[model samples]
Target chain A: MTGPLLPDLDRPKAFAAPWEAQAFALVVKLHERGLFEWPEFAARLSAEIHAHPDQPYYVSWHEAAVELLVDKGLMEAGAFLDQARAVVRFRASDHHHVARLTPIAVDPARAG
Target chain B: MAGQHDDHDHDDHSHGDHSHEGHDHDHFHRIHSEEVDALLMSIADIEISARVKALEELLTQKGLVDPSALDAVVDLYENQIGPKNGARVIARAWADPVYKAWLLADPNAAIADLGFAGAQGENMVALENTADVHNVVVCTLCSCYPWPVLGLPPVWYKSMPYRTRIVRDPRSVLAEFGTVLPDSTEIRVWDSNSEVRYLVVPRRPEGTEGLDEAALAALVSRDSMIGVTEALSPEPA
Candidate 1:
């Protein structure tokens, strides 16, 4: 934890919510995968601190997690860019399947 | 949990109102929530074992495609892809206004430009976040989403609670994600009952001023696309 600081759990319930749990999960997984050892994760946090010295000290843990993963090659850096291009190819007719269910028929004869 | 889905068992929870089996089973192929829950259990077993012994037997009996290949594809779709594409779309919308407009109007064309084509994401919409009003996307049933943009619904986003609550009480829902909006903020509740899922192109923060497009794009998080939160200020590296 070389980052400026960890998130404060005492601030509000939102800060301690489950959303952060998933973000933390990615951090733990990144660590387990050997993408960045403890020292490297600490170094990345340190770097973020040097860079954003003045910003509020909140949720940087999650940002550091994403940055460390991208920096350590665990996750694709172009993930967001790729998603933008993917959202453009929309079709009007596809809205019909929004509530569509798998077609599984039960014959009237099968009714008990 | 199966028979419970037939009726609103958790009415006090506010989310139990959206009934998945509201239709008459006579005209429908009704699979109760319990049945789906069992199917999910089987799927989990197959997924965890990697062997999928029952799947293999069924495939052998019904002459289905290579079971291994099918599982691999399912794994790729379920695990590998989804949120990444969503981030990409959000980044682009942040960078280009015209492109963002096009994305809002016709999301499929915008996404195709990035070489991602799919059945679920064909009719897409990009809902941009403003300071006053915010938008969050969710599927009321199972986790149907614009996976081509978003990689996958985060576990929290896919919860029965989130799906049912977000539509009725978006302000409160966003609060759980640490997003607080003033009473003036008009939350557009996009009922994604159809496959036209939505992504929130969060407004770029101020500290990131003068940063280039690439730098700005880096700050937009996956949760921002789902409209739970806004993008953070882009920190200098």
Candidate 2:
């Protein structure tokens, strides 16, 4: 409250997407569980943001979480990178193109 | 969970999109395959679920994180705590005139008396919406919100568009949210910071004069508490 004030922004909602919420929840839970302190997380997040200036804010947050997890030795760097790659591959090769189908009406008359 | 190696080169894409235009340091550059680039793009664009699931599994497997504990935290925000807590406070203020006076005079102590004091709500300020005055809350720098009373913020509240545009043009922003106030009604926006957070106590809607405190509390919406919209009028029972 005492620092230089930032311009007031319209806070329409808390989370823009599910990933943002997950990222937020992960950070808070990790802090609560003593994985890292809030200030540490904030510093990592600031560093992440500094590194990737153009990326969305939450993406930077996600990267910071990854970096902190790796730095703390709580998560393996190679394993995380591998998992991230695997997830990317899964989406690219198997999941991405699956078309969503609308539910078929049980009765023709019921179909609108 | 360590030894299996995929022949794919994961190290190539270590530097995804580091535009070092402002920085004057020479950083190592790694050559990336087109396939790896495409995969990274997909992960960044639309595969957040996959990435999140993978991260969660990795942490859980390492015994560093507990899934139930994470769920408990999310559930606490999503359910146990929320604007309903704020609604109760607002309803009490509306029901009791002396309490309303006290709330306006000293919101921090008033809110704590109602058992809604902790975390981001350590310093509280209640802005009352009257016939000619409306109050809205926003945090421009980061999403510093009243967690004790309002729970986790919605996605849009922390968005870049909202953060940049709200102060410059609040009426337009409120209009986008379908909140059209009269020109005669002066709009006041409260900027929330780490030290002080704000709660908008909307004017009680007309009708339902016989409604009890519980009923009044039930009518309070999260948007109304944020001052984006007004409380809903009573529906025919």
Per-candidate TM equals 0.47, 0.50
Q: What are the candidates' interface root-mean-square deviations?
A: 20.1, 17.7
Report lDDT (Cα) of residue B46, candidate 2: 28
Docking class of 2: incorrect
Off by over 4 Å in 1: A1-112, B1-83
Candidate DockQ values, in order, are 0.03, 0.08
Q: Ten consecutive residues with minimal summed lDDT in candidate 1 chain A?
A: A85-94
The best candidate by DockQ is 2
What lDDT score belongs to each candidate, Candidate 1 first?
0.48, 0.60
**For candidate 2, lDDT tens digit of each residue in A3-82?**
12211122123443334555566777777677776778777777777777776676677778888888888887668766
lDDT of 1: 0.48
